[model samples]
Target: MASDAGVPDPETQSLDADELAFSDEGIEATLSPADPESDIAAIFDALFLISRLAQHNFPARIDIHTFAYLACLMSIYSGQPANEWGYSFSAVPPTLPYSPTLDGAIDRLVETDYLKTSKSTDVTNLAEFELTPEGERELGFFSTLSLLSRRLQFLDASTSAAVFTSSAAVVNSLANEPQLAAATHLNSSRQLLTESSTARLYDEFEALSQAIGKTDVNLILPASMYVSYLQSVMRATAEEATGEAVENA
Candidate 1:
């Protein structure tokens, strides 16, 4: 039950889709793109899409300090390209805003196995960090979680309040409007921050609403849709908890 359409390797790395479908019984449903055309199928499809995007966009690993400072660099160099990433970090030239010093981060990365030390004899600060094979694998997983945390921060910046949809039924209804659903994720994403400084695990989520409207829209929107499913489940659970409290009172 797998599609050969651009699947990444299946090794010690099983960083597959994290969006899961639950039936009325709270059991995860097996998904198929070929099932009957209901909201259920659409929801599963969206989950699958987001998971793929997360896996694909996942980046190399770095410690908490560098992660905290990465937002500045990402926005600063959104469209820019660098032939050498290690030098790129060194070039940021950390300042007194209490930023994670890129130079320091590069050194830590070298000490840890995350980055390999390949000397650049010609240039002064041009250290080469070919992310270790282990780093490559960890990067794939941790990058996804990092991406979501950054998205949450971006969303917080734009909105003073949390947008909580209050029902699973609402989520089911929105699943069909994929574009609109993805739009809900725009506040967060693109910067790749995380809560835990030592975060190295992927969130069991695949879709990202944060990057849904862009040209890479096709790949990310489906993943973004999973947010809808999560929102609905959360809303319903909260409502039930409230109702139970009232009954107890």
Candidate 2:
């Protein structure tokens, strides 16, 4: 069920802590604190989260691209705060990537039976899409993957919490050993760069991993290599047939 806020009602929401049981331990500390700087990020997170849930749950079909586009347009029309759309929308016309532009991707999705288009309720508007049975099966797989990802995130948060616990323990231990207090820099110089470097590296690694995963390796992998692999299998089959013919003779 949807709320007046235009997002799903939390009570009716399917993907919740009770339904999925993603690890909750030590994640409380890692939860992001809301502030003005994070407004745009929060908007996107909300938009995508609701979009995925809507696609998976709602009877009426909506693709992510269409939903995002319309939502942005409507938000502007309804006088949503400037900060919500500012940083990303400054450009007059944004560049969409090659091969699978929004239109192209939607077309391909429909062609592959992942989605099906139907006439809109209002004739003035364009058609909307709904998931096919195949699409729902794919969505089930996606949900499974999302559950695993949440578990991993929770595990990571728990490890970070453990580190904080260990650090506190060390600080307490140092308090007992007054001699070591002078040796430690905990109260004095802060090495911000060293502390933040690991986090930056992790962010880079995650970004690279995501980029690599999204890449169409079929476009990059040599066609000749695939041909050679198939040819070797065919050659082995031909040799086996020859041996069988000779035995029969």
TM-score of each: 0.24, 0.24
Model 1, 111-191: lDDT tens digits are 766656455455524333455666556545544543222232312211111123222232233322222223333432121
RMSD in Å for model 1: 19.7
Query: Clash pairs of candidate 1?
Result: 50-206, 50-207, 50-223, 51-206, 151-188, 151-189, 207-223
Q: Over the stretch 45-108, how does candidate 2's per-residue lDDT look in tens digits?
A: 2223233433333312222322332232222222222223211211111111011123434455
Q: Candidate 1 — worst ten consecutive residues by lDDT sum? A: 21-30
lDDT of 2 at 143: 43
**What is the alpha-carbon lDDT for the whole of candidate 1?**
0.29
What are the runs in model 1 whose C-alpha is more than 4 Å off? 1-100, 120-124, 146-249
Worst 10 residues of 2 by lDDT: 90-99
* lDDT scores of the candidates, listed in order: 0.29, 0.30
